[model samples]
Target: MAQKNIVVIGAGFAGVYATKKLARKLKHNNDVTITLIDKHSYFTYMTELHEIAANRVAEDAIQYDLHRLFGRRKNVNLVTDTVTTIDRDQHLVKTKHGAYPYDYVILGIGSEPNDFGTPGVKEHGFTLGSWESAIQLKQHITDVVRRGAVEHDPKKRQALLSIVVVGSGFTGTETIGELRDWRDQLAKENKLDPEEIKFSLMEMAPTIMNMLDRSDAAKAEKYMQKRGIAVMKNTGVVGVHEDHVDLKDGSTFPTATLIWTAGVKASDQAAQFGLTQGRGGRIAVNAQMQSQDDDQIYVVGDVSYFAGNSDRGEPQIVQGAEASAQTALSNIIKQINGQAADVAYKASYSGFMVSLGSRYGVANLMGIFHLSGFFAMLMKHLVNMLYFVQIFSGYYLFQYVMHEFFRTQNDRNLMRGHLSRQGNVLWAVPSRIFLGAMWLVDCAYKVSGKESWFVDKLRLPFSWLQPAATSGASAAGADTTSAATGAAASGAADTATTAAKSVFSLSYQYGKDPMMVFDQMPHWMYSITKVLIPNQQVAFFMQKSMTIIEILIGLALVAGLFTWVSGGVSVMFTLIFCLSGMFYWVNIWMIPMAIAVMNGSGRAFGLDKWVVPYLQKVFGKWWYGQPQSLYGQDTVK
Candidate 1:
């Protein structure tokens, strides 16, 4: 078999993921090589550009290192170059330094901001297409706010503070939504009143968010209006200048920042190739995503115009780009395998969710169900997380979680500042140590009871070991010995602690010794108990083993050695005890403490600060054959 080269042009949502999918499926095929070429070292998460532009997240939050992504894949090759031209006849792609011939080509050259020949927009307006542009706009916003705070003239400050976003698409609406959060936050930072900084969204159509359901769009508009964002519908932007925007109604508004998110046209590379160009400079493609003039060349993403089965035949968002990529790649793979490229592409989009901000959103799922507020926002984040999981696995998903939840600024995240708690691991040290001390006390009591754990005839009262009938009889026998039945409500009666009434209106109490709170043990637990301790000798051995485990867990936690392991064991013990009816209301405090201690609590004043790294070095050598550890430092082989 002859070697086949698959060249993908861009590393955006479409090209990168298609290449990744190819690399995985054809990993063992020696006759194929998947080469991913891009101009940058990192892949910019384009959907998250609005978050960075509005200062909700840092610039690096939306960047995924391409080298880190494909480091372990042997069959995939990474190229850092700007593609100058594609020779369709020769099946060759030409870059500045070299030319690479491909058997099959995937064209994913992305879109650029469409100024629509509007005067001065290309020179004066900012567009959120590239990572650089987003960062530049973010800094520009900050500079405008800073100057507005100290300006002596009121009109100049007002002009400087006004920010108008012309377009009501996802990009425009989402950008304004994030800016809604930044409005008050940046105001305080600049020592200016938030009300003075104006935000306006202009749309030429009768309604905003034309991509979404009308009701959802209306709800989004209402949310913007409530937050002081001027939603300008049926408004046409005729011209954009250095300091003002001229509307179609013969009116001009002064503004320093004019963000243009109106429309996107295909990149110049599309037209330069001299293919069958369609509207918006897009190359026309068939249902199989193959170019009209060439069957070997497949075009995906925003640059490919497939004007069938879809409303407009052009996809602007990430979902459409990804779906087109899938369709294109599926046919490419089929053709490679000598099968008919018969996978027809059609548009069946699930739904759209627009976040008004980090805290609130409106969602229309499957065009049937509608949701708003926190749940909608949460659903929107879950969709992003799910997408990250699909394109890239745990690493990208984890990074998104960290950026959106823990590292997010201004309490503007999915968790709403709850998971943003930082610098508190040191404070958990006291709680971790205290919890370990209590476990040691319990172990001490178990060592020297009337019938000690390992001594003659172990007398450990496992509440779930016996049947319900036997347990009830034992409780009945002990009641005759209780002389006092009427103690105060707060006091224990008959040596049994009275619990709060159950939700089912069932009265239950924590038993002293002979009985437990749950009347019947679960079937699984009963079956396991029968096998685990069938005889006195087995029960005694099991009790001794349990005591040994407890002592080790307590000592390790107290010393802060392997706290993740010790804390996990403690949590397991806590869960088991609660399920077995051995834990009372007083013992419930261990659950949170167990969880907290596992989260780097031992790093502060604990042995795991030093121990985990050495263990990581050993584990690294054992697993990946490297002296340098995966999670820790380098050590001897």
Candidate 2:
């Protein structure tokens, strides 16, 4: 039998996951082949584009490899090429690379930024639609500042630093938040005054974050203003010139950078393929994830017009992309198995997580309750990490962890091609060598059972206690000549060894205190750690441990750095993090770190499994910093 070829287009979140699920579902059948076509081999996370554009993160900070998502699926083949035309009549698709003849076609090709026909918008404005666009925006923003710093005229300098972001949707609002952060960092880095930088977010609608609830929208607007962004409601760009944006109200603002994220329209490719388009030129697909007019065709993600509501009762959102993909994969499996392909997909907004720069944001899970402040920020980061784990199979997450821990500022952006500056390649070679060394060390620590090499090489005093104690015991043994002294020595040795073993064991022991073990602790207590300790006792323990650890680590890393020069730089870098930020000084940062370590790496699919060996190799030698690259170095700094 000729094999059934399932061709999927686009490599966005929907297209990437759709191919994976379909391949898995049809893997048992030898008569099925799953081929995914994308313009790029890797999946670029559209959500984190703002972070890249603002320079808080590298371009690859949010990207995941599609091949990693496929795992060991022999049936899945990834082809990187631009699709020029799709001929449904002949069951064929022509791409710049080659032509694909498919038994079934799934068009998950995502949308492009909507210019809304504003003058000079296409030529002047930067759109955060793809990884490339985001990178370009970041570079352009940096160039603007670099040029402006040398300019003598104050107004011209301000104009050069001025950035106008159109639209107030998730992308628009988030981009503004990042822009504020990047601007702040740039101001500080370049010694330019904050007043010289202008970040304006203009929306035609009555409020920003329009998709969010009214209260959330209000909170977001307030938060944005507090972060130095001017949120203009019921205002929009009527025209965009090379150096300025004319507002709808006829007010004009001088600016060098204009970002058009006002709206999104379906890809012309989708319309050319003849899929029924909705209001935004989005392809309309049936409940089964297949095109309404053709079962062999599937359309998922942002391009798909799924039935849903956004305050007003209307169909929108790409959340249905995942739902549609699942259904399409299920249908494809059933079709290959000679069974009924009738799985219906019902789209529902499960949750919404948004990152508002480094500090604050809003979320309404299932549009039921609103979350903001630290909780929302945590949720947003988790959402990003989860997506990383999902698509890249945690490779980039591990890369993130390694970079966070060991890589220097110069080293962080070395492999990131999108973050290149017009500098000599000389700095990059050493950076690559350093990363390569870290990776090799990580691999060795994994392959070999050398879990403590990092600690040993770094010679952390906490770890050195073992050798110090052994030396003390040896000294005591040498002096013990009497029977009574020998007996006392033996007893002390046994007690000390038992205590050390208990403290060294990373796994939580179930035996606990005999008193608690005898209590036959309630089943709920196992899930809830708080119940195990009374609130008062919890407070007491935290108060005591918090100060002691903070002081000791602070003094040792900070004060001790002034004494020693070998690990001084790394220690100072780590210590500066502690004293520099008020957030780090608070309980918020430590509490989460403690909880994550205790919970054992998000239960499953975390990079912990990969990080364990990597950390073991560099454990003592270098501090394992947070898993984000270079503390937003690519942006302004």
Candidate 3:
């Protein structure tokens, strides 16, 4: 059988999920191959772009590596290129790099900001359509604020500090909330008055968050107003200039930054495909998400116009995108197997969730449950985690949680400006190497002997003590015989053998018996350890295994690999020793030192400082928690 090549374009929510579904279904089939193409090598979590722009989260937090996403799938091929056009006659998708021939093509190219022919808007305003754009917006805001902080002229400073956000939909509202919080932080850090900053959200509609319930929308608006953000209703931006924004109502706002989140239309690539364009310049599709002109071509995501149980059209939300993608992939697979395209696209609206900032949110679940404040914020995180787990790995979920919930303002401040210039490596390098060497020496000594110290102690109480004693006795007997000829030499030998025997006997009594150590422990700890390991044989095996593990940990620490992991293990070991009645004065100091090492002491001079960022770039942002230096530089703030 000839192999069927299925091409999926874009790596957004729709493209990603569709490729995953297709890969899973065709994993065992040798007759089918899936190819995924996207302009960027990484997939951006579009929903979280606002957080990036607000500086609430790191830019890397919203990206998932395309290579890693398809790394394990043998039948999936990933192409990082922009699609320029589609050749329907030859069944080929032409990209900037090359053309991919396909038996079927799934277009999930997503959407672009709609400037709506507003004069100077596209040239002067920024939109949150892509990751790069969000980053640009963030950097521009930072630059503006910094300039404002040092400006001597009040008018110029006000203009630099003022920010106008056009449109009060989900993106606009969320961006304003985050921007306001960020502005306050920036002002405090720069020793400027917070009152100097001006933030506004302008919408042409009667209410903000139009997709949200009326009560929820009102609550959101009130929350924004309470936080000192100007909420303008029925206000539309007619044009934007380099230093100010012009509203449709003949009002002008002097601002250096104008953010356009007014609306989104189908990506220009949709029209380039020569497909039947429908409302909003999206590709027209049937109930199954197949193009009206060709059954072999399917469209999904924001670029696909599908009217499912709605007169207007399906909402261009992540949930709808996923559902449409699923339906489209199902139909494509069915057609590949010479079966009918029976599955129809269904629209599902779980609810709308909007994060006001790190501390606040408003959400309506299933149109029945209303949530706000901290609980709503928690729910928002949960929803993000769910989607992350579905589309990416648990690493991304962990990163999201840490960035959203645990990372402090101080930590985020480290990520600002040039990260490559921060952190002192002088002490970190030597300290890590020295600590690792100590562990390695300890491990080597324990494993070098025919029977390790632990094993010797374990066998001492059983049968090895008698053999040791006999050996000592034989040496003493030899010493006695030699005494007949050379009394001085014989006496010295006898004393040495006697000392050795005594030392062995002491070790046998104390070392072999962990119970003796347990007796010295506090009653509370003693009872816990006793209950934990009631079996003597099991305890012996555990001791041996721990020794081997220590050896591995030592090697890793010495190599400067997984520095934090090794340090954490060292802490665990120290704690275990302390609880087992081995609490020496040195052990107490080791605990704190281990903690220091775990907190990125390796980054100062060790391999981790350099390797971590590289790994994060190649594998995505889920490598570890916030580093001491975010982009290889110290905290600028």
RMSD values for the candidates in order, in angstroms, are 6.8, 15.1, 12.0
TM-score of each: 0.84, 0.65, 0.74
Lowest lDDT 10-mer window, candidate 2?
Answer: 513-522
Residue 170, candidate 3: Cα error in Å is 1.4
**Per-candidate clash tally:** 0, 9, 5
Q: Number of clashes in model 3?
A: 5
Query: Where does candidate 2 stray beyond 4 Å?
Result: 307-318, 388-392, 400-637
Lowest-scoring 10 consecutive residues by lDDT in candidate 3? 626-635
Better of 1 and 3 by TM-score: 1
- lDDT digits (tens) for residues 166-226 of candidate 3: 9877788888888887876888877888988889898898878988888998888899899
Tens digits of per-residue lDDT, candidate 1, 196-264, equal: 999999999998998888888888998899999999988998988877889999999889899999999
| Best-to-worst TM-score order | 1, 3, 2
Residue 447 in model 2: lDDT: 27
lDDT of 3: 0.76
Between prediction 1 and prediction 2, which has the larger lDDT? 1
Q: Which RMSD does model 2 reach against the true structure?
A: 15.1
lDDT of 1 at 621: 55
Tell me the whole-model lDDT of each prediction, alpha carbons only. Answer: 0.79, 0.62, 0.76
Report clash pairs, candidate 1: none
